[model samples]
Target chain A: MSTGGHKGATAAGRLSVLVGALSVPAFVGLWELIARSRIVNAVLFPPPSTVAVAVLDWIQSGQFFGDLSASLFRVTVGFLIGTAGGIMLGVLTGRFRLVSSLLSPLFHILRPIPPIAFVPIVILWFGLSETGKLFLVVWGVFFTVWLATHIGVQKVDRGLVRAALMLGTPRRQMLSEIILLGALPYIVVGLRTAVSISFYTLVAAELAGAFAGIVYRIEIAQQNMQTGQVMGGLAALGLLSFVADRSFAAIAERAVWWR
Target chain B: MVAMMHNPLRPTPPLRLVDAPPEPSSTAPEAIIRVENLSIVFDVPRGEVIAVDRVSLAVMPGEFVSLVGPSGCGKSTLLNAMAGLERPFEGEVIVAGKPMLAPRPDIGMVFQQPHLFPWKSVRRNIAHGPRALGKSKTEALRIADDLIEMIGLTKFASAYPHTLSGGMQQRVAIARALANQPRELLMDEPFGALDAQTRAVMQDNLLELRDRINATIVFVTHDIDEAILLSDRVLIMSAGPGRILRDLSVGLPRPRSSAILTDPAYLALKRDCLDLIRTEGRKAFEQMEAVT
Candidate 1:
């Protein structure tokens, strides 16, 4: 009886795997049929074939590479700068009450205000340049990483700190090694959240004003009423952010090496 | 030290044991740790609570002393004072003729939990102490390798703390403490978290380790048998504004093992300790009852 149940369970598992594999293809096929059938206006909601053709044409066009690199550069450089600043400040505020008292209140107020809300002020401050776009992405990523590291540092095991103190761990080593490494798990978690936030803010940044980017191309395509190109741009953005999040997750797993 | 009297309300056991001996006076070598009238107070929400009340004791160089008491008796608090991890509300703890205001490299401590660095391997964890004290990487790692071998964890030297068993992790903690070659080792129930079998093995390991290291050791535990088994002197403490009740000396010969747990002399000493602790435990219980 148990063997029969086990066999049935394996069969169900295999069926679920097959179903999952077909899920996206099935949805696309249905959307294609519905669009061609005129259930929806094809111009507004282009069929999968049209979108695929537009994406292929985009790759063939020399402008695609420029757009892709521009978007990638802003995200990568902005993420790195924001992450660095966040971790440095997080360690300071987390370790020192004086530093925390001076900065935490200000950060709390600024953190809740959406980064996109700063678009008008950022343009005024830095104009419609790369700096403003970078600032928006950095603003979005910084608070998340900072809060995670701050909480992580505070939550470090008291027992470990006491043990380190007993071992005569010098003050500097205590902060760099024990305190920092102890809080790394939390920091990594914050960093992962920041990855997605960086992409979200990129949308706002590129929408505000950009010479070249995936979102910029989408806006240009919308102006020309090229629905297929617009849909293709959206897909590209989704795929990029999805890849970023997954790759970061893999990196994060290794970051907390002990775990 | 105050001696405990047998309870007249209950019939006495057949064991005929000598009363606790008087505290040893100052002799040739000066004490390595001298806790003078130390008291620690903690502020709770309602009011302040006295954890240790005017506790004074001295541990001689190379002496193995155990502070035995019930839970919340402040024996650990007193031990923390010696480690400079706790501040005295009044008086002070002097180690090596200097008041202990902060933890010094020359003094080491092992806590109930292993508290090993989860990110570091056994070797790196042990090396942390030496490296923190400004030793070069090579010298620190060499010290770590030696201590790892001493702790019989050479096979698992590169294993992280979370990967090891509780007993193995604690062995690494001990090695880490010894990495600095501290003049004084303070252990707050180092084996209390282990199972009975593991704890027994650790006690034997500690006994063997003690003979080789020349450091003065101060151990804290609530287990009477454990206290008597490992210590040259066992100081019994009473709870409720914790105070020392008796100081008993174990005159058992060295090169001892779990085999001594059955010896007649050992049994007699154990009985006396149990009797005193049982009475004190009752008094503490009654006092708590009255408070509520």
Candidate 2:
């Protein structure tokens, strides 16, 4: 008998999209209801519409763009460093057992220590400045991407390696072509995860004894009793994260199609 | 045929030649692949196991040779040693009139799995060896295009390995191997993974291809019929400390077919090979059972 199971899949997919489309409005509506009821004090938990207006005012006034740029610039720098180092190290270790043994211990020791855990230490070391923030972001992105790359390289096809050997490919070309191409699916996974880490580390970096960032702006809004401004800043961070994740996901999908 | 007549088959005739009259090259000096008392040993927990025991052979330039034996006969090992992937404990393998100490572009190899890079298109895979061999990028690309067409994959040059069938994939591997224009080709059960029908068809395609190209080929297989069908001469090896049991020349006319498999001469050749292997293989198996 025919399974006819595709009907359930189609219905589930439709429902999933509908739920995603409704999330923002549902969140905004709930906030308004809660504010009117004075459940947590409108000053403490501002209505979503209030936050929306504050966000619009910030963008129109161009105050939001500067903070956004500064945070993004920091993330961009740290992300590049982390990703480059990770890929290089990953490949080196994957190809050579000697490199793997020498470097694996360092990776294990560093991986479990949360990048945010370095915030206080980083402040002491880099003096609560951009350097401190950059350091935090770099550490955060590096280990995650590194782990992904290393695993990817390790997982490459043994048959492909042997084939390359038989076909007269030199060791260098084997690395650049066969091994590198083999690790592409791993790189995609690493890149997608690294983008999330970049965003995550950026927030942590900003919050760690910082000023003039989105996180700092929210903190200031709280102290000033500007409930709407605080809500606006928080929502801005969430939107940025959502957009980045979606974009990375789209790119990953395209890459996998070709890869 | 002058260029390739000194093929590995030249030295290794099958069981029929065990008592044949001695020939001139049987004492002649120069050989392409000179295996002298080559032995290969494997490390086991209890002790050491020897795969090849002081076996020696030679292949001349431009010859089409087949190393045919039952499973675990060390034919592939001998092939690998010649390719310089493995070192013999007791002897040496000289290739192209030089000691083959390591792998090089001069010696091409085809494995059972097509081993085509899944991410790359057929054209890219075919050109891989040439590129790695330091040919100019433009030259490599041109050569790759020519080879893709040669392999009858011109229309499918842009297709990835996953999109191709097993036979097509192996064709790509073969194209890739020959891209470097190697002096000789070492094939380890190249068609062993394909179905019987596909294998038969591929065997013919390969023979046709061989007629066009003059590269010496050392083909390894467990199939007696395939060995007879493809080779100019078949070297049947004995198992359990593999050594050449018989080196017989297949005198059947080329452009052969499945019908040839039933020919009395071919059948007799197969029977002789089976006779040697059947005893050796059974003895090896019984020995293993005794140990267990």
Interface RMSD of each: 0.6, 1.9
Off by over 4 Å in 2: A1-20, B1-28, B43-48
Which residue pairs clash within candidate 2?
A: B4-B62, B4-B63, B6-B60, B7-B63, B13-B247, B13-B248, B14-B246, B14-B247, B14-B248
Relative to the true structure, how large is the alpha-carbon lDDT of every model?
0.91, 0.82
Native contacts conserved, per model: 0.98, 0.64
Fnat for candidate 1 (0 to 1): 0.98
Clashes within 3 Å, all models in order:
0, 9
True contacts kept of 2: 0.64
Distance (Å) between predicted and true CA of A168, model 2? 3.3
lDDT (10s digit) by residue, model 1, range B217-239:
99999988888889899999997
Docking class of 1: medium
Model 1, position A213: C-alpha lDDT score: 97
lDDT of 2: 0.82
- Estimated TM-score per prediction? 0.93, 0.89
Per-residue error for A90 in candidate 1, Å, reads: 1.7
Over A117-220, each residue of candidate 2 has an lDDT whose tens digit, in order, gives 88888888998888888888889888888888888888998879877887777778788877877888988888888888888888788877676678877877
lDDT of 1 by residue, A1-259 (tens): 1325587877888888899999999999999999999989999999999999999999998788999999999999999999999998999999899999999999999999999999999989988899999999999999999999899999999999999999989898888899999999999999999999999999999998889999999999999999999999999999999999999999999999998
